[model samples]
Target: MDGSDQGLECLRLLNEIIADFDELLKEDRFRGIDKIKTVGSTYMAVVGLIPEYKIQPNDPNSVRRHMTALIEYVKAMRHSLQEINSHSYNNFMLRVGKSAFN
Candidate 1:
């Protein structure tokens, strides 16, 4: 494909991916994670920020549970993004950055 054609194809794929993200965010599965804002092409989220972080450093069980939940959430999100890329036949990669505070 030519330059313009490639650009158009990417745009089309992006539109579809955005729609998928919108639907995913509306689901109840990701209740704790809140969508802060989309900066440029990045989607930012906070896991238990307003209500304070639930994991306590002293409690190993609490920390383990929260960590497990975060891992599951990230895996699900990554799978969804990978599915979108596969369906679109595009090699779009997602870069995720995570930070946790006690």
Candidate 2:
């Protein structure tokens, strides 16, 4: 979205990327191609992996914890984005200490 942040022109282009993201997620295109999603714009992106606490059963407690962690991660990403590249432009990563299950 940083490109979108560049100006109105970039913003126009963002519509396409956002649309693509929506499609990818909706169609489960990333199911087999599952990878960490990273956004240059902190305002967008669903993050929160590396479950510190083992996820178990179908309890709301696990949901709450995961949501909390995701929220924190989102906030931190936003903050970092604001700090790093207001002048230039922005960028997630890696596949370690993690497993893929879907």
Candidate 3:
């Protein structure tokens, strides 16, 4: 295999990873999460961006729900990566960082 072949294989693996992540967002449990974009291999996503999913100012439960969803999404992504690694020769490591913005 030449340089171009290796590059194509990398891109193919990346596409498969991204597709798996995108599919997770389509699930009912993750409906409130939005896929902002992908920067290289980093997957960017936001929770409670949608009006319906927004956290209420006075409701602690609402905030809890939003945070829970975000955490769940992260867990799901990590799990997906593990599954991907198990099937492929590549071993992907996931690092997650979360923030809240008004």
lDDT of each: 0.68, 0.43, 0.88
Candidate 3's C-alpha runs over 4 A off are none
Per-candidate RMSD, Å: 3.1, 11.8, 1.2
| Candidate 2 local Cα displacement, residue 11, angstroms | 22
- lDDT by residue (tens digit), candidate 3, 14-82: 899999999998989888888999999988998878888877879999878878988998899889989
Q: Write the per-residue lDDT of candidate 2 for residues 8-46, one digit (tens) a residue.
A: 755554544444444443333222222255464322333
- Candidate 2: the clashing residue pairs are none
Mark the regions of model 2 whose C-alpha exceeds 4 Å error after superposition.
1-52, 87-101
Q: Give the Å shift of residue 28 in candidate 3.
A: 0.6
Instruction: Give the per-residue lDDT of model 1 (tens digit) for 20-96.
Output: 66566566655556668766567776665536554466898866766665566667767878998677666777777
TM-score of 2: 0.36
Ranking by lDDT: 3, 1, 2
- Please report the candidate that would top TM-score against the real structure: 3
What's the distance in Å from true for residue 40, model 2? 11
TM-score of each: 0.66, 0.36, 0.92
Misplaced by over 4 Å in model 1 are 1-5, 52-63, 100-102
lDDT of 3: 0.88
Give the better candidate number (1 or 3) by lDDT: 3
Ranking by TM-score: 3, 1, 2
